[model samples]
Each structure stands twice: as C-alpha cells, then as structure tokens.
Target: MSTTDCIITSSVVPDELRLNVLPCYLGRHYLTGESMVYDWAARLCSSYEGGHWNFFTLSNGGFYMAPSNMDRVHVRWYMNGYSDMMGADAFGITVTLFALCHLAEHTLDDVIVTRYHQLREFAVHHAEAANILRAID
Candidate 1:
C-alpha cells in the first residue's frame, strides 16, 4: 500500500478560508485496507462538485457575502477529521444558503433545492461507506 496521506481540502469565498476538510480517502483506504473509501470518495466528490456549482450559481454572489461569524463557524467545523464533520458542514452550508436566499428576497427554486437533496444523498453515501469500512476493519 502507498504511504502517502490523503489531504481533502475545501474552498469557500476567500482563498484564506480554504481548509483541509478531511484526510485523503486514499490514505484512509490504505490504512483501513478497505476499497469502500476509494469508491465512496469518488462518488461523493463528484456529487459535491456538482452541488457546489449549482448552489454557487443560485447564490449570485450572496453566498460569499456571509458575515464574518458564519465564515469563522465554517472554518472551525471543517478542521475536524471525523466523517460526520462533513455531514454537519454540508447541513450548515445548505441552511446558510437557504437562509441567505430568503433574506435576500430570493426564492430557492427547484434546482437549488434539488442540489441540496443531492448533497444530502452524497453525505449519506459517504456515511455508509465509512460504516462499511469500519465494519471490515
């Protein structure tokens, strides 16, 4: 197995806000000797990228307009290494986006809502993958 560690990073409004969201799935797979992490990470990353773009478009720049407190909250939450940390981050982002859309007198159309659902699905998939990997370990 490879000795390289996995580095999962996330990008937000500002470059300085970038964070390592989680350990690399490759490293996790190597450590756990389980294939699920690789499979799930591929799936989750694809879904996450798509959802991110969809929400980004809907924000019309409002997403980045969040207050300093919100940004700080996100940065701190993302630093944790647990898998559920991703889920919380996902939920928090979704909620913040929806709230911002409403506060801006904008409606979250079906597309945006669908993207949130996609993110939720991806989170569940990741959770299942983690559970399976844990079981095998």
Candidate 2:
C-alpha cells in the first residue's frame, strides 16, 4: 500500500490519553481507558471478538483503537442519521469528532478547538477517511 493508503497504529493505547480523553470524555475511570472506549463502542460495533486490537492516535492528541481483522468491528451508527458498516477505527474517530464538534459549538475553548482541529486533520488523511466523512455527513 502507498503512504496515502495507510493508517498509523500503536500496539497498545497510549498512556497519556488516560488523562486527556478517557477520564473526562470516554469515561470517568483512569485505568480503564482502553475498556471504556471498547465498551462505549460496543453500542454500535458488532464485535471485538477479533484478534488483538491496535491503537491509533494523532501527534497532537486523540485515541482510536481497532481490532486487527480487516472487517474490524462493524459499526452501525451516526450522528446525522446516516448509518452503515464502518470499521471500528473510522467509527471511533467519527464519534470523537462529533463530540468535539458539539462541545465547540457552545464556547470557543482553545483546548477544545485545538483538539478538534488536530483530530480533524488526522481524520482527513486517514485511510478510513471516506467512512468517517460519510458518517459525519
């Protein structure tokens, strides 16, 4: 695959996100950051029964974890009423973007705006960008 056809991954979730995203955003627990994302995703993703999942994050700050199966976890959810099969990677990133979008709509918090842009920039280049944008639209 070419450079434009790949997504960066981490063998495990980054520890830093426990403080920035997991606790307040994904869940209230610190240590269960990984599980929190998985559990929340369970609402839509059909399964995590696949092999070990890999984590994806941006250089600035964000977290998305997806199983190794090319099928990934099929997610059937969307904020805009558009729904279809989207990999867990794309689904997770899309939800995070939506959450950030809603939060930013209220006030112009620099931190929130920065994170929104960071993840948006990352998502636009991601291999699953099409799925993500489809869900968002």
Candidate 3:
C-alpha cells in the first residue's frame, strides 16, 4: 500500500468516542521530552465525549488515544532536530492502529500484539517497547 494509505488505514476507526487514537508523531514528541506535546494531546483527548481520549507516557515518548472501543486514533510526525557532527537528526511520524482491546486490557490488543507475543518467546526481546508499539500500532 502507499505510505499515506497505510498510515490512514492504521489510524482510522469508527466515529465513536470510546476508542483511543494516538498519532505516532505526538507519541514520539512526548517520548523525546517535549512538554507541550503532552498538553496538546491531553486537550485533544479531552475534547471528545465521555472522556474517550487519554494520554499515555511511555519511556520514550507520549501518545494520545481513546480509552474504549469505537474511537479513532490519529498521528503525524515532523523533523525536530539533527546532529551535525554525527550526521544524525531527530524526526517523527504519526501512527494509528486498532485499539479495541487496549481499552479494556490496559495492554495491546490487535494483530501487532500477536506478533509481538510471538517475538517475545525468543531471547533479547524488547518487551517494553513491544508493549508500547503494540498498543500504538
């Protein structure tokens, strides 16, 4: 699929107010120590009915999503900064995924979750990252 299509499909959800939809860009910013990102995400979540959206902070960043089923998630990314000496830079992207199960489980709930669980059976697995991504995706 095209990149835009993939992103939209992953982030799209029913027009309900119970699901959590956190874009990847917001999540990354929150993880990278941007305080304003969290505030914006919180405000966006609060705008929904029934307090559907909620903000979550992971070790690496923050994300916004609905707390129940029937909610949608949207994310976008942008360039933040880069390193001149190391030729490195910081960038971001928004990501969305099915989150029906996360609302009730306090964990991931989708195809990604299954894949992560399988990956975890092996040694040297990033359980924490996997957990966060699983929910975000």
Candidate 4:
C-alpha cells in the first residue's frame, strides 16, 4: 500500500510544529499496500510522486502516513480497529499512536512502552488531541 494514497495536505504553518494542522480532503479514500511494511519498526517518508507513499517514523516507534498531496482533500477514514471514522490527518496520527500503544501492551517491552508514553504526552497538545485520545482510549 502507499501512504497518503487517500490523503491530502495543505499549507503547513511554521513547518516546525509537532502537529502541523493541515486541511482535509473529501470522500472515502485510502492507500493500498501488499505487505511491504506492516511489521517493520519505521521508515523515512518518501514522495508519492516518486512512486512511494509518504510514511513517517515517529520518535517513539512505528510509523504513520504523512500527507503527500499539497492540495487539501477531505477523506473520511473508517478506522477498522475501533470502528471510528476520522479525518485524514487525525487518522494518521491516531493510528500511529494506536500502534505504539498496542505494541507496548502486547510486547511488554519497557522501551516500546516508554516510547508510547512519550508520544502520548506530546499528543495532548496536538490540534487533533481529542481525536487521538478517543482512538487510543
């Protein structure tokens, strides 16, 4: 599957904010993947134009899709994990955080768990804090 396959990105404010808010696109969209990266820790995001979907590695662990399209698009994502529908940006962040939390819980790895907490701490200040909390909760 590709990243940002079904997502869009608008103008980034300062370009340095941890959770730079971006506009969302419309419709039910998604990036499709076979099995290239459903188990790895993380990978550097690449340009979708370059044939690779943008997947970003979080500081804690695991990865999330970054909006590669410059035009803001609206996408209603159905998070199968929790049956929750969310916007593109919120979906990416929440799913990434969810993976970290699940990894920590299942593996019981001190390091992974710590990373989950670290990201969770930072997420509280994110623009999509409420959405992230709902998914993670």
**Candidate that scores best on TM-score:** 2
Q: How far is candidate 1 from the true structure (C-alpha RMSD, Å)?
A: 17.6
**Taking the tens digit of each residue's C-alpha lDDT, what string does model 2 give over 1-137?**
86445564433456554345445433333344454445545555556443455556555455555555556445555445655676656766765666555555645556556656767777888788888777666
- Candidate 1: lDDT over CA atoms? 0.29
List candidate 1 stretches off by more than 4 Å: 1-108, 128-137
Winning candidate number (lDDT): 2
> Per-residue CA lDDT of candidate 1, range 76-106, in tens?
2222332332343443343333332232233
Alpha carbon lDDT of each predicted model: 0.29, 0.58, 0.28, 0.41
Reference-based TM-score, model 1: 0.23
Per-prediction tally of clashes: 1, 0, 24, 10
Per-model TM-score on C-alpha atoms? 0.23, 0.55, 0.18, 0.44
- What is the descending lDDT order? 2, 4, 1, 3
**Which pairs clash (backbone N, Cα, C closer than 3 Å) in model 1?**
6-24
Misplaced by over 4 Å in model 4 are 1-85
RMSD of each: 17.6, 6.4, 14.7, 13.5
Better structure of 2 and 4 per TM-score: 2
Tens digits of per-residue lDDT, candidate 4, 15-75, equal: 3543322111101111111122222213212211322234544433323444444332232
Q: In candidate 3, what are the lDDT values of residues 66-105, reduced to their tens digit?
A: 2443234332212322111100000011112222222224
